[model samples]
Target: MVIFGCVGIIAGCGSLGLWLANRIRRRPVELREFLMALSLLDTEIVWGATPLPEAFGILKERTDAPWQGFFADLQDRLQRGESASIAWNDVSLAQNSHFCLKHEDWQVIRDVSKGLGRSDRQEQHKQLELIQRQLALIKDQAGIWSEKQAKMWSYLGFLCGIAGVLILI
Candidate 1:
């Protein structure tokens, strides 16, 4: 009886641990989505005369998702008067954030910061395209991972059920 109980306990704990791990692994996906949306917002506001803080604040408030932590971090960094490029780099470090500012975009932002006229607006669309691609890639990976998890958990549950039956027998 003790042996059966021990086995059951261990299996239960293992199953729970696996489930938790799967849940935690999904954070990166959410992070990427938040970054994508934030980037798009930045693009839309780039040509506006609105102060970065005010624009960012409005975007943050309007964002209807569980990204307060991410947005707050970005807002804090921006409030420090950090350059947009640098702020973007920081934001890109979050999990699921696969974006890296292209050299062209970086050059454009940097030149503008140094008092050069705003570079052409072409790069914003390119960057948005890149973000879309990244989102699609992450979505694909998440789908595969979830499918695999479903199969794995099904097998695990089946085995656990069989084991329990053997124990009761």
Candidate 2:
């Protein structure tokens, strides 16, 4: 029973560490997805000349979860007669908890909502391009940080588990 309990403790700690590491790794992937979705939105707005609600509907259909939800909510808000800027800002804030992005990423997103749908296609395109660039930089940094810290977090948890077992024994 004693040995089993120690093993359970070690396993639990190791699992927790792995989960945290997985979260770190997911951030870059999520950011990349967001970047792709933004590119799609740009295409819709620039070339297709789609309206905001229609573009958001397309995004809601094409994107994965979290992003899909974000666009869906934005589309719904727009359909309900809310201003584009308000819809974007409200959706971004309301769905903020669902995303794995960092503070800087959120800041760029917030900036995006500020000018959305308030300007001509040229201005919107420039704004979206700028946000995409910022997000790409953040994604690269997150990828590097995840590669370094994920292993450290996993090892730290296992080491702590081992220390606990040693002390108890």
Candidate 3:
């Protein structure tokens, strides 16, 4: 009974650590994929002239969850007649926000979301290009940060679990 209890405790701790580490590891990849989705949106808008709801619907198809969920939520909001800025703010930041974007990233997007369809086509293109550049920088930073933190978090969790077992013993 005692041996089984100890094994369970250690395993639980290690699993927790691994889960935390995996979350840290995946964040950068999520951001990168999000950038791709945004770029795809740019393409559909610039070339296809697809409206928000349709463009977002295309994005939802291209992406995976929680990102897929983000785009779907956006589609829903747009269908509900929410403005681009409000939909983005409410959906991206408030709802389905498992995405761990930095505040600056959100600000960059939120700022651009405000002007989404208000301007002429050429102006909207320029705004999108600018947003693309900002998102690129964010993607790069996320990659760097994730590389640094992911392994550390994982090992830290595993070690903490072992330490917990040791303390118990």
Which candidate number would show the highest lDDT if scored against the true structure?
A: 2
Model 3: clashing residue pairs?
A: none
Could you say which candidate leads in TM-score? 2
28 Cα displacement, candidate 1 (Å) = 8.0
Residue-level error in angstroms, candidate 3, position 60: 1.4
Q: What total of clashing residue pairs does each candidate reach?
A: 0, 0, 0
| Ranked candidates (lDDT, high to low) | 2, 3, 1
What's the lDDT for candidate 2? 0.90
* Per-residue lDDT over 1-169 for candidate 3, one digit per residue giving the tens place of the 0 to 100 score: 9788777877887788778777767767776787788788888888889998999999999999888988898999999998877788788677436866667767776766867877766677788888878888877887888877877877777777678778988
Order the numbered candidates by TM-score, best leading: 2, 3, 1
Expressed as tens digits, the lDDT of each residue in 1-169 for candidate 2 is 9999999889888888888888888899999999999999999999999999999999999999989999999999999999998888888889989887787788888888866899988899999999999999999999999989899889878888888899999
lDDT of every predicted structure (CA atoms): 0.53, 0.90, 0.79
Candidate 1 or 3, higher TM-score?
A: 3
What are the runs in model 1 whose C-alpha is more than 4 Å off?
A: 1-8, 14-18, 24-32, 35-43, 46-51, 64-66, 91-122, 153-169
Q: Give the alpha carbon lDDT tens digit for every residue of 77-156 in model 1.
A: 78897866566556545522332223332332233222211333455445545555555565566556756765676567
